[model samples]
Target: SPRFIALCPTTLSSSSSSGAVDEEEQRLRSDLRERFLRTLLLMTDKQVEFNMHEKVRVRARFGASDIDVLNFQVSGLETPLGVQKEALLRCQDVISCSFEL
Candidate 1:
């Protein structure tokens, strides 16, 4: 018991360690969110290609996305059957998406 107590971290040290970890996690989250927002801004009105499951691919003009990333709003969507003026594509159906510079 004495050896275990000596090996265990003190309350203050443990709290500091937890605080450092939380700070690091917050920093990473903020960085990622900023980058994603920038990417969305750059993608506005640009031509984007969406690759979906079952080998289905489509091209559309980037409009916007919901805050939760659940759906994407696109314009001039080109599909196999026909073209859609505007449509909302569910993120769940998409495998990947890309755009050119």
Candidate 2:
């Protein structure tokens, strides 16, 4: 699916949005959440999602500033009953990169 191709985290972060933290990161994160929900939609009879909370931990590059992101949806799909193996990778703090989206 075309959307699946857009699922590439790096691509979405670098190409789809502007900047790393403000746009790229957030868009990519939300996209992943939506994809997960879409899959669940195909499985369950009714809508079965209320929110999506993702805890992202990032390290500092050259300095001593860390980006620890605590993302949670106030209103959305309900959290899945059990979270077993989550395929998630946290992108550490922005160090010395000039990525202007």
Q: Assess each prediction's global lDDT (C-alpha) against the native.
A: 0.86, 0.35
What is the alpha-carbon lDDT of model 1 when measured against the actual structure?
0.86
Candidate 1 Cα errors over 4 Å, as ranges:
1-17
lDDT of 2 by residue, 49-84 (tens): 221224322211111112222222111222244332
Model 1 agreement with the true structure over 14-47: per-residue lDDT tens digits: 6565877666766786899899989988998999
Residue 43 CA displacement from its true place in model 1, Å: 1.1
Q: What is the TM-score of each candidate against the true structure?
A: 0.80, 0.25
lDDT for 7 in candidate 2 is 54
Model 2 lDDT, residue 89, Cα: 22
